[model samples]
Target chain A: MRGQKDIFIVADNIVSPLGGTTAENFSRLVAGITGVRRQDRPEMADQPFYAALFGSMDGEDLLTEDAAASHAAGGGFTVFERLLASSVADALHQAPGIHPADDRTILIVCSTKGNTHLLDIDDHTPAERISLPGSAAVVARHFGFTQTPIVVSNACISGLLGMITGMRLLRSGLFDNAVVTGADVITKFILSGFGSFQALSPGHCRPFDRDRDGINLGEGAGTMVLSTRREYRHGLRLRGGAVSNDANHISGPSRTGRELGDAIEVALREAGCGAAGVGFISAHGTATAYNDEMEAKAITLAGLNAAPVNSLKGYYGHTLGAAGLIESIVTLASMREGIVVPSAGFETNGVSAPLNICRSLLRGPLDTCLKTASGFGGCNAAVVLSK
Target chain B: MEYITGSCVIDGEGGYKNEKKIFSFAAGSSQPAGYLPALYQHFNWQYPKFFKMDNLSRLGFAAAELLLEGWETGAYQPQEVAVVLSNANSSLDTDYRYTQTTKDIPSPSVFVYTLPNIVTGEICIRHRFKGENAFFLSTGFDPALLTRYVGYLLEAGIARACITGWVEWLGEGFKAALFLIERKETAGAVPFTAGNMDRIFKISMPCE
Candidate 1:
């Protein structure tokens, strides 16, 4: 596999309650900040047993009524779009030379619930209300990208896959530069949907904890600007990536970890690196009973037992489609800052393998890091990055 | 651009057995039920015992089976094949039923199939494929994105061959068309260009 273009994440931004940018979010994460809270909806008032976790963003700072009104004209974009736009703007501002409208640039957006908030409203048809294509068109129009914009809606792997798509587009000479973004907002449908599945944690999530119950749904957005190696510099290089299917179960994870491990191995081999070269691993620890165990197995299968690993679920809850990119930004930040944040809320080790769950912030110079995510449908993706 | 070496579609009629020979398109609806019986007939091979099958599974299984016909299993091991699909409504029928069950008592089995990518997983399990896989959900077809993604999969060497297409099954209507694509050394027959797409969608072929 080819290395990412000189494109660097010159700037990064986020809109979680933790803070609005990489610095603020990482600072809160290092300080062990937890953005989850109890449910506040009127209908959910009596359900004290259920708490809703959310990554609240500053709406006023992220969107304007006029902008929302423009989106509202087409029935309005969701909070997810607004947060995504803010992050995209921040990324572009950091990379001053890049322009969204450049013919050579491509925009790839990822979201499992792209304007799904519109689904809650009753004014439009199902096609119009939950229109992912329209939401993507809105983003593309905002960026003035005349080129065909690609939107990926894969479950949790959406962001990682979106990055991979952008990389492919650049390599194919389809575009010189690409902007990749992933965003999702909490909605009643998602909450009730997960609730119906009994997958929601009663309180704050405790990824990899012995008493880990389930995942706490959260929302946020992350954007990264990618260009050919000849066009940009100072960004973490995307070295290699792979995606695979367990082919074992849809909702459940494969116990053997064969398929998941193979994806990581392929990514490492493509990057011309070995397991030992990986400094740390950003795991998709969803605080669920099966996902954490399966991830531990996959890591062991990849022979990364000594590498320090952590899941940011405790910091941001499970961000669904945004988890891959959001956690990836966190991993990149850690690489830049020479510090690995601890896996917050991981008090007890439950799985058999002894994983190096960062109990506290570890400060050191790091180079290569692995970001792995697994989702519904047995979909798994792994990407390797170099500092 | 990749070439669609092999393409097939099964609707209400049986496999390669649509007497009408022409796929139907209606004004009021997105799905034309002309291929449902053919799709189900082909799918019945694996699911003979089950009283009913979900549309996603039924369509995925039928499409994949058609693509793999006459192909050597040893040469193209199940693990070397990948399924890349796109759809619009997601698993809406399943989602509707899943939501309805929540009003009384929810069934875990039904809830598991709510995610859109589950159909891809089901296909993989049925064929035992462990290769790179993805499911892109979009409102409508964008052949450009599909071509780019398929080319990426081939170039990455993640899968020797891939079954890619659009499968949307909502209400009484459903449409599924899949193409089996493999890399070529030089210009070959069955190029996956706009002409081929038009031929597959608009033209009719005589039965063998």
Candidate 2:
């Protein structure tokens, strides 16, 4: 590991179905509140599909709310831009000393589909509204960040990779601080895509359960401000992380789970923490048959079978790019509170490999934790966080 | 402290390797169709999935392939070869296409290419690289940020080599300028400093 590996996550926020603040979201998770539900929106076809959406199932309402929250009247701002702005606003306000305009600070946006809702067309909205860079530019300008923001769009791994990027920027000494944020809202574009893959569950997503069918789509935004400066003290230290491609399939996960395992092994090595050192494992746990099985194999291969594992998809319903950030922030909260959030929908041994899946909110001091995410396009990422 | 050992540029006009115009489009070239598939055929590359990726991924993939053709990242571990790519428009072309499908049942195939880093993932899959990779979107290329990040990767001992630079596809045209940055600055390898990067980025012509 480099001499500068400790990139501290000083502040974070989550805009989800449960609540807007990270504290509210954590409390809801502890109380076992799930954001996923079946919806029969006109755009989603006649059949109802289970998903997690935020504030008024009315799509138009969220868009207007997003624009209203930004205090801008239709200058081509997007729903995600609002979520990103507010979440970052909260983090910057709470974190203290995080100057968005400083050259040493860079805003990194992560998402799978930024402003994709503009794709709905309606025969009027300009095609340029779909530009991810343009959306990022709006968010950066709104926050008065001097540096033009950078976007990471690596499917579901985008959020986890965003945090990892922040840590690397600090570790590389390229920047002293990074504002990492990501969001993805369920739209006809994504819902149909996952449906085509047969990856969506018809019922509530039962992650790590024997009866698990598929995943429930979700929407939300999350933010994390990471810094290397000692003044940003007393936060979860992002110790080590690694990303790897399965190289086995684009749409499907590796059948052997070797590459994901390799990523975890390397991250563990980089963090100077062994399998036993990780007190909790916040897995990607999409609840699809393949992903859950693959994660099980990877976890066992990394010799972390005994680590208490949890998947937050049941609560937030797999917020795509926001999944990693929401999960990481909640886990950090759990660490501070000396509690372990349960794997919401897990029951009965589902996969072949042995796992210590949390059945309930386990009270324990979690000093070190691991966060992993796998996505389409054959990508897997693992990050280590410590108190 | 290191070097950009090899670089390749591609666009609507033709292809260049280190500023030498290596491939040129035929006189009758019309790009209402897939310019990328034609280039893939010209290169005689045998990856079928290349046909599925959008222009952005194809541009980055083909550019990386060209850079890796003459230059050698010999003896570097697979994971040690990282990728750091940036672009101005983050998959806007494909985003529009995916949106068109939204009126009907959105095609999952096209929807997957909506993310910019899918290009990095494509490169990784082709080379079997299980390494660190990221895709950054900016209003324009910023050499200072790019060079600093790449330099840190090499100096921090995180990556022995990296495929880094700009790849963006917008409207009817696309641009890709990829450089293979390595740890060891050997003969003929230009030192990858901020000043040199800005110079080459402006000129973008063959070093000759």
Candidate 3:
């Protein structure tokens, strides 16, 4: 049997309304600044909706100076592709030794909907361009990647699933490095769909709070480069990750959250870490009544209810596919800096279970952090990261 | 290593199970939209949720039903079974339908199925397989990728049995080739290799 290979976080970048690089985003988060606000775009919705949207220059403006110059001359990449490429490029810039075109490296794209907005423009668009694989291929070629990019489209869990897939492949010796990116842009299509479901919070979302209403959607991209070689700063390791389904409902979360709890337990076991060893948890905390309740129940079931828990949704809203990666990036940064970022919108206990929800930033020595995500299609994922 | 114990294939023409012709469509029968319902009736499966499923979910749900017909008798625990599926087009069929609804009041039912993994969820909901699940989008049927990923899951002991394959639906064209994978090799089961999977998929849908 092959020995288990250690996976390390080499570099990461978060391109969202908060900031461009991971450090910038982390600073803004520590300052208690929220990117979500009221937007009255008639094309997106008849009534104003709260979302964290990029100002005027979606993702193109967030590109590095070198990338911006090239993009100024007709980059031709869509908003979604630009978000992904820019993020991957920024992370790659951090580690110059990790070549995008290396045979030992692989790319994984995670998104709930990529280029689906093109469909709203007109009916004449080619099917290939509107497909997820097409978008992935485009991103892969942008960086001259030698291997075929793997695309994960599993609703909201796509990002974390992408990371897990990369870890598995690397452990299997298929590749030595994995550039995993998760991105999704908000559009009229998505807004209307969530509107139809009545899952959108009219104001800023209050995750795990008594006044919690619904989710506030956001648009952004996050990229994390994972490698077998421990040649990066922070020395954050991808300890263990697991995924599961509720098998109860397609759109609704499990009433019991036992499935999610099982996944969390399995992840902790795989990480060879105990519940008491966990320093903090980054809950999904989408702010929906059912989702927050289910997550709280899952956390309590896993016996980690006493750990300090925070949700980045109050800071970034729910970036859909990008939620897992962006939130994970922030969680790792917090773990590295020994700072427990507060759960922005959390104040009073909203669910039936008791939780140590953080309401203020704290500075303490932290070693390990757990990030959890739940999405449509009853999918749930959890990953353990340690310094 | 894992072995392919059972398999099911569904195309526009008909459906097949373990190399046996379980059912075939009538000559010039319902090309795409109606074949799923007909297959559902042919199997005599009674799940009202079938009607609510989009084409992708309907295709996957029916294929899974056939693939796990006799195998669902507790060979593996509910949490020990996993579903890993992929497709070229990620729910484009449902996307188109939901896009149409977006012009007016987008139907929540239609909007819910816009993601590809919803089919995996439907299968899990129907069979109570609460294990790990994932949905990938590939340019085409990449047997090598599926084989490697499932092998990793089985080797890692993440799942004892996994339902993995390609189920795609776009416009009037749909294909569902599902396989039931397990660690123990049974009589007549084939090794779950990429080459073997490619051959089986080729023979299951000769026209492709």
How would you encode candidate 1's per-residue C-alpha lDDT over A1-387 as one tens digit per residue? 554343344455665667667888888887777777666664322264333244233254556343555565783556666777767767777777777778898888888766655544432446644556666777777767787677787788988988777777776777878888888887655666777678888887888899899888887888877878554566678877888899887778888777778889988997789999999999999888888888899999999988999998887877888888889999988998998988977999987776889998899998999999998888999998887
Can you tell me which runs of candidate 1 are displaced by over 4 Å? A1-7, A44-46, A49-75, A229-231, B11-43, B48-53, B92-107, B184-189, B203-208
lDDT scores of the candidates, listed in order: 0.73, 0.81, 0.89
Residue A141, model 3: lDDT of: 80
Measured with C-alpha atoms, the lDDT of residue B176 in candidate 2 is 87
Once superposed on the true structure, which residue ranges of model 2 sit more than 4 Å away at CA?
A57-76, B32-34, B198-208
Highest-scoring model, TM-score: 3
Docking class of 3: high
User: What's the true lDDT of residue A13 in model 1?
Assistant: 64
> Residue-wise lDDT of candidate 3 within A39-62, one digit each (tens)?
987867788889999885345466
Q: For residue B108, what is the lDDT in candidate 1?
A: 70
For residue B73, give model 1's deviation from the true position in Å: 2.9
Ranking by lDDT: 3, 2, 1
In the range A1-387, model 2's lDDT, one tens digit per residue, is: 646557888798888878778898888888888988888787654579888887553333444343465565555456667777767877788877889889999999998877666565353565455567788888888777998777787778899988887887778777889999998877777787788677889989988999999999899888999999887677779888888877666678989888889889988888989998999999999999999999999999999989999998888898888898888998889899998888988889899996999998899788999999998878889999998
Chain B vs. true chain B: TM-score per candidate: 0.76, 0.91, 0.96
What are the per-model C-alpha RMSD values against the true structure?
A: 4.0, 2.7, 1.6
TM-score of chain A of each: 0.92, 0.95, 0.97
Cα displacement (Å) at residue A342, model 3: 1.1
